[model samples]
Target: MPTTTALPPSVLISEVGPRDGLQSVSRTMPTAAKLAWIDALHGAGLREIEVCSFVPAKLLPQMADAAEVVRHALGKPGLTVMALVPNLRGAEAALAAGVHKLTLPVSASAAHSLANVRKTREQMIEEIRNIAALRDERAPGVKIEAGISTAFGCTIQGAVAEDDVIWMAEQAIAAGADESGLSDTTGMANPAQVQRLFKRLRAALGEHAGAAHMHNTRGLGLANCLAAYEAGVRTFDASQGGLGGCPYAPGASGNVVTEDLVFMFESMGVDTGVDLGRLAAGRAALANGLPGEPLYGMTPEAGLTKGFVYANGRRPATERLLAPLAP
Candidate 1:
């Protein structure tokens, strides 16, 4: 029998493609194809996936089948089905859908908050409080995560104050969020800022410190994720093929690529519990679902290094050493 190699998972990679990727695009993916793409992602060992958003169909028709998608995902054993919700009503809908988790989008930038969700940061926190209360009443098992968008910098309000971001995160937590994570909605985050902000977040929130949601708009997505990892962040939000962004937030495009981020960590001996080859199959499903749409990822295009070895004791037949290069 072949040796059973099981390296303990070092990090949690929450995939946001099924929701964010589809919502940002102009066309709606057929329900069958959406389910297939999700199956592919699950097949690739993606444990957590934000399958859809529970908003009004008029607002985001692409996510109209949120409940059906959640139902399909629920059939997958060991998979956490998550959905995005903006307000208490959305949370109720998601709870009804039987999702495993709910991620609420709360923009740290007041301007972006109003533009995206039509509410102020203070009001959003109150909404979170209500949503959490409802969750406690309806489905206590589901986790509620607050994703603070534009936490790094806002396209509408450039250069958001770091203090403001921290304050917003604290407010969300106090308002009853299980965890609060920051998002580079405009893709303006750098490695230094990422490290500093996440460090402060960990200190303030302690165990409540959440995932880093970085974008590849300016090509620093992977670097920022690495910085967050160094700052003790274990959960990361990434999209398949870099297919995600905010339609409300101008110039905010390209979520951190799932393939590249997984490769970055696994290559550095930090197990992401993701198989690159399997991930490519998921990518193919994504591409097939939305034909003619371009997908992006250096790891997918450049291919994994020869004799690559995963931190989890899995590797090619000719295993090569993975290490840092001498400067």
Candidate 2:
């Protein structure tokens, strides 16, 4: 049997709660809960989080307080404040709010691109160009990341060619996106597909290639994430409680669950640096924030198995409680 080698010393779990998690839900989280959840996530040792989107408040009332959330999160020591920007206008707002990182979504599937952002892949690249110029002018120290959504497959276009995915990553980087990442928007990704695509993307974009954003629609979220990790991807995007989904794409289980993904990595001796118990506490805060929304995850429900030791060898309370149940 092959012995399991320890994973990297530290990995970044970029929380997508304020953006990916909130966008799909109908009820908007209260501004105070948003702040508290962000604080709790930071307390759980998550340094990076996509706190909000700089889109118009009318479009996503859920994130109407993007500036406030970004400002508040930025104040937390060592936290890399991140926010999404859909266009140049949004980028301006993000810059004004002093976000440490700004992400923009560019679709590889041309059909999906036209449907979601109402732009061709090429047009989206042009937008990246414009956004890049604005970033250089206003937020010189801030990072720009292009999140290439629907890179694996698309519900609208179907069969998003791998070549197109690679091409988009290269184009986005060339167009001045500081880094580029892949998002499996429709959740039609497999482990093999993930490993192959991330390998090709790394080869094509070099260091500019970014993290893998996956979904659990097919119950392969963790498997695909592991595949990507093996392919040399470092950062990952996950939502608290797996709350979001594409209304357009049926059965897509939003983003990967942060707690479960953290558990998978920590259990395998990978240092995610996130505290699962504190992450669950963050999720619990979500209930009061967005009442009646269903939060999904196995780790949070079944709890960690007995003797569950994290990568650092610390025993989680779940394991401690299994001490013969005080019989």
Candidate 3:
């Protein structure tokens, strides 16, 4: 029960590499490799995965295999397969693909919304309502998550108002979104902002509030996640090897590194239910799956240190042998 006392009794780290990670990279991972990587991640004890975004193939050729990936993920037992859908059509495609969860990004900043999705804030809310209604009528059990991107600030439009983010969350929840959470789209979030926003979101939306999706643009991704955890947020969205960034936002690092985050929490006696050694193995699978794609993360390259005890037992032999080499 290390995590029980050190951190929340339980935490869910949602892997976003398949969707968010690959989308940002230029090379397309073959469908078979992507499937194998997903299998490896699940074997490492990752329960939820954002497999792909259900957008127009013409727009993001990388995600053209979203339906195939979704189908593959669904075949894995106890795995929660999630997909990003920009509009009602994408949502329909996602549901038809039998994904367990669907997330739609709704920007809090009007300018960012218009730039990213070509819709105003209100129009995005309406889209969520329509999608929710569609899900209710068609796939009653598929979970809908509203990812409020640019909840902190935007690169194009700086200093996004917190009130605006909270209002958007309210509107999405009111429109029947199963859950809503904030995304640091521009990587402009700080620890204080993350703590405050998540605290307010949980207070407003209660259990329907989702995770903290952060980027390491300023190297504060892990810090922001810790702040959210302190504010009672358990679920986190991360990518293997930190592979993901906003194409629209310059200088933003990839998603928080799954290996490092797991190490941070588990090292502090927090149980993430993720085996760090196995997680690294999963990352290797990821690399092999998409060769030539640049992967990011400190822990993977630096390796684990001595006396690192995982929640299950002593550090695996592979990790012990590969301890961080002398700098």
For model 2, how does the per-residue alpha-carbon lDDT over 192-278 read when each residue is reduced to its tens digit? 999999999999988898988988888888899999999999899898888784533445466788988998888888888887877
The sequence of per-residue lDDT tens digits that candidate 3 reaches over residues 200-284 is: 9999999999989988988899999999999999899999888886633444466898888887877776678887766766777
lDDT of 1 by residue, 1-327 (tens): 899877655999999999988988989999998998899889878999999999999989999999999999999999999999988899999999899999998888989989987888899999999998999999899998998889888889888988998999999999888999999888788999999999999999999989999988877888899999999999999998888765334443488889888889888888887887777768777877898776777777777797788887787442321212222
How many Å off is the CA of 278 in candidate 2?
1.3
User: Which stretch of 10 consecutive residues in model 2 shows the poorest summed lDDT?
Assistant: 318-327
Estimate TM-scores for all models: 0.92, 0.93, 0.92
A best-first ranking of the candidates according to their lDDT comes to 1, 3, 2
What is each predicted model's overall lDDT from 0 to 1?
A: 0.87, 0.85, 0.86
> Could you tell me the TM-score of candidate 2?
0.93
Order the numbered candidates by TM-score, best leading: 2, 3, 1
